[model samples]
Target: MTSPSSPSSSSDAEIVVVDLFAGAGGLSTGIAQACEALGGTLGEDVRLVAINHSEDAIATHEQNHPWAEHYHAKIEELHPPDVVDPGAVTLLAGGPSCTHHSNARGGKPIREQERASAWHVLHWIQQLRPEQLLIENVPEFRSWSRVIDGEATNDGAIYQQWIQTLQALGYTIIRDDRGRYGVTLRACDYGDPTSRRRLFVIGSRTHKPTAPEPTHSADPEDDLREYRTAATIIDWSDRGESIWARSRPLAKNTMQRIAEGIRRHCDDRLAPYADVVETLGPEDVEQLQDDVVPIDDLETAVKERTEPFLVTGEVAIADGGVTGEEPDPGAVLVMGQHSGAYPRDAQGRPVPTVTTTGAIHHIAVDAFVKPRNLPQRGVHSNATYDPGAQPAHTITARNHDGHLVSPYLIVYNGQSDAADVDEPLPTVRTKARHALIEPDLFPWGLDIRYRLLEPHETKQAQGFPADYEICGDTKRSVRKQIGNAVPVNLARALGAHILSWNTPSLSTFGGGVTADPETEIPAYAEVSSTDD
Candidate 1:
C-alpha cells in the first residue's frame, strides 16, 4: 500500500491532511473542497487520509471519497508511515467523539477512557508535528475537568493542560487575549441550512490562524448573505416519496389522549365566550341562539347588563369596553379575544437546533369554537389546523409520541388544494421521523400521522451535495450517519478560512500570525511528563 502522506507527484505542492476519528469524511471533504476553491487540485495538491473506528462510517466515506486513504481501525492502532516525514505534513484535523464531553450527555462523571481519547490527538501531534492542527468537538470540551487518581481537578484543567502541551511542543494555540481557546461557530452562520453549533480549536506551529468570518447572518444588516433556509435546498418534488410522507398510524390510546388534550384546550378558550352567555337574560339568550342578535349585539347587551358593576365612573363603553369589578346584582359581561394554544414560526426564518431526536409541535391557529346557533355536541373546531406557512421544528430521532411530537395539524381548506406546504423543513435527526395532520382523512376530524425523511433529504438539509451517497443497509443506520456528520457547507467555510491563512492575498486578514503575548506562560503550568 502507498504511504498515507505520500504526494501524488513530486512537482505538486500538496497540503497533506489526516482526519482522525473522521466520520463519513465530512471534515476531509470540506478541506478538499476549500483547497480546490483556492486553486489547489484535489487528490494531487491536497491529499487526504481519514481514520475512523466504525466500519460502516468508513465504508460510507470510502464510497463517497474513494481517492482519500482510509483506515478502519481504532486510533490507538494507527501510526505515521515511515516513508513520510512528520514535519512535511501540512495539516491535521479531527473531532474526537464528543459524547463524553457533550452537554446533552449530561454531567456524568468524566470517563477516564473517554477523556483519554482526546490525548490520542496529542499523540499524533507529537508524532507528525504537523504545521497546523484543527480540533472540532462539543463546546463543552473546553470546560471538561480531569479526574486524576479518582480526585477531580480544576474545572478546565484538562483543556488547559492540552493547550500548554501544544505550546510547549513549539505550537501556538489560537485563543483570544483572555486565553479562551476554541471559537464556537453555528452552521447557519456559515450558510448551512441546519443550525448546528460546534467548537473549533486551531493550533499552529508557525502562525495563528484567524477564525473564519461569518458569511451568513441571523440579522439582515450584519451578514453578507441571508441564511440559507431549508426550503431552498430541499427537493419539494420528491417530498411525497420521503419516508416522512407516509403515514405512521398513531396508537389508539395515544390518539385518544391527543383528543382529550384538544378538548381541554377548546374548553379553556370557550370559557370567556360561555361567560358572555351567562350574563344574558332569557330573551337575549334565546335571541343569540336563534341568530336574531349579532355577536356584537349580544356583547353589547352583556355589557349593558354589567354596566352597573363598572368601577370607573364613566358609563360610556370604549372600544376595549368596560373592564372592572362585578356589580352586585347586574354586571355587564366583558369578552376577550381567545389566544392561540400552539407554537409556530414563519417560513422565512431558520429552523430550531437539530438534535439526535426531532421536535414536533401543533401548528398554532385560531381555536375552533361552535357557532352560537350550533349545539355544543362534539369537538367541531380543531386548534391543530395547519396554516401551511410555518417552518418545521427541530428534527429528532423519535417521533412516535403524539403528545410530544405533535404533528402539524392541517385542515383541508378545499378538496382541490394540494397537501404541499411551502414551509422550511425541520432539522434532520437520526430517526428522521416527522408527521403531518390530515383533517381530510377523517370525516370532519383531524388524524395525526407519521412519516420518515428520505436519507437524501436529510443529507440535503446538512448541506451535502444532492448526489452524495450514504452507504448503509438500514435506513436507521443511514439516518444516524447523516445526523452525526457535520454540514458540508460549514466544513467548507472553515476549510476556506484555513486555506486563506496560506494564501498571500487572504493572509492579510490577520497575517496568519498571533500577536506576541504581553506575558509569558505561568511557571506552575510548565509541561511535564505527568501532564499527560
Candidate 2:
C-alpha cells in the first residue's frame, strides 16, 4: 500500500482527473472547459484519463477530446496503478451505469452485478488515494441496498457501506443538514436548457469542497439569470431541411386515433360557447381577428362562425389556390385540447425532465371537415409547440423510436415568433418522434408530418457545443451516447467549484483547510456498533 505522506513535486499543481464510465466525454468536456475558464491549460493544467466499456462511446469521447488518454474496457478488467503518490491525483470522477437505480425502470429487480460496479471506485481510490473523489448518479443511488447471493440486504446498506469505507480510508463525505451524503443538482440551475436532476457525491481526503452554487434559476425574482430556453440553443432557421431523418410519417392506425382524439376535444371546447355565440353581433365577431381578443369572446366566435361552417370532401385547386367547399354536417371537425403531452409556455422556462421516451404533443384539428385525400404522414403521441417561445425537451437515448410521443413546434403561416402561444416544451426522449400539423395540406382539419430530431439538435439540447462531433456509426448509437451523458454546463459548474477549492495559490497542500485527523471518529465504526 502507498503511504499518504508522499512528497509533492512542482508538477503536482496540475489537476489530474480519472473518469470511469465516461460516456462520450460529457463530463470530461465540462471539466476541460472549466479548467480553461479558470485560466488553466487544457492538457497541461488538467489531464484526463477516461475509461468506458463501450467502444462506440470511447470513440466519441476520443473524437471530442483528442488529448485525453482513453481506455475502452470494463472497470473490473483494469488494474489501478500500484505506485500511489498522495496528492498526485487531484480528482477521480465518474458515474456508474444507473440502470438498476433509475425510478423509470419501474421497480425491476436490481442487478447485483451492476449495483456492485460502484465498488470499482473504491478499488481505484484504494490504489491512488486521490485528494478528491466525485461520483454522479441518480438520486436513488444513495439508498442502494446490498444484494448477496440473490438475497437483498438492509435498505441503504450499500450506500452506508460506501460512506463507511470512504471514512475508513481517511476521506470526509460531504453531506447536507439531513445527513444525506450526496448533493442533488438540476442542470437548469447551471444554465443548461434541459432540466436534469442528478445526485453528486463529492468526497475529500482533507478539505471539504463547497457545493456548487446555482448560476441560473426558474424564479423570476432571483438575482440569477433565467434558465436558457430551447430556442437559444437550437437554430430555428436550419429547420433540419438537409437532414432526412427529421420528419417521419405516422402509421394509419395512429393517425386515426389522433383524428378521433381531436374530434372529441373540439366537441368539448365548442359545447360551452354555443349558447353565447347567438348573442354576438358583426362588430363583436370582428374582434376575433385581433390577436389579443378575450378568451370568452374568441370561444363564442369560433363556435358560432368557425364551427358552423365546416368544409367537406376533396378540396379543389385552381392555379395553386384552394377553393372553398360547402359545409358537411356528417363529417365532424375536431380540435385537440392541451393534454399536457407536450407541456410548454412562452416565457422560456426550463424544459421538464428528459426520459428515454421523448415528449408527446397533442394533435389538434385546424378545421372541422374530413378531406377525401389525407396525407399518409404523421407520428403517434407526438406534441406540437410554438417554436419561438418554448425550449427543446430533454434529449434521451430512446428518441430513435418513432412510435414514442415527442414534441413538435409548429411555425404557422411563416410566423417566426411563438411567444403569443403559452406553453413549455416537454422532456425529450430517444423514442418519442414529433409530428408537424399543416392545415393547408388536408381539406379536413390539418395535415400532420412526423420526424425524429437530428443528432446535432440533441447534442445542442444537452448543452454540448454546436460543433461537437457525435461519433457513432448510426443515429441510434449516437442518441444513446448523448442521452446517457451528463449535461455539459452542469458538469462544468461542479468542476469549477472543485478547481476553486483546490487552487494551490489559495490554500495549503490539501487545497482548503481540512478537519484534523486525530479528532475524527471512523464513520463506519460508529454505524457498525449502533443497534437497530
By TM-score, the best candidate is: 2
lDDT of 2 at 314: 28
Off-target runs (Cα >4 Å) in candidate 1 are 1-11, 82-84, 108-110, 148-154, 176-178, 233-445, 502-532
**Tens digit of per-residue lDDT, candidate 2, span 1-532:** 1112333242734778888878877789898888889888766666777888888899888888887777787877766562234447878889987767765454456668877788888988888888887899878787788776654553776777777788777776777566567788777778776655688988886665458889887577899877675545443333211010123322334334333323332334432222322233333323322232222232343444432221112222222232333222123222222222221111221111101111122223232111111123232223433222333444455432112111211221111111100112223344333222212221212222223445676677678898889887887788788878888888899888986784222122223333434333243121221232
- TM of each candidate vs. truth: 0.61, 0.64
After superposition of all CA atoms, the RMSD between model 1 and the true structure is 15.9
C-alpha lDDT values of all predictions: 0.49, 0.52
User: Runs in model 2 with CA error above 4 Å?
Assistant: 1-13, 82-86, 148-154, 233-394, 400-445, 502-532
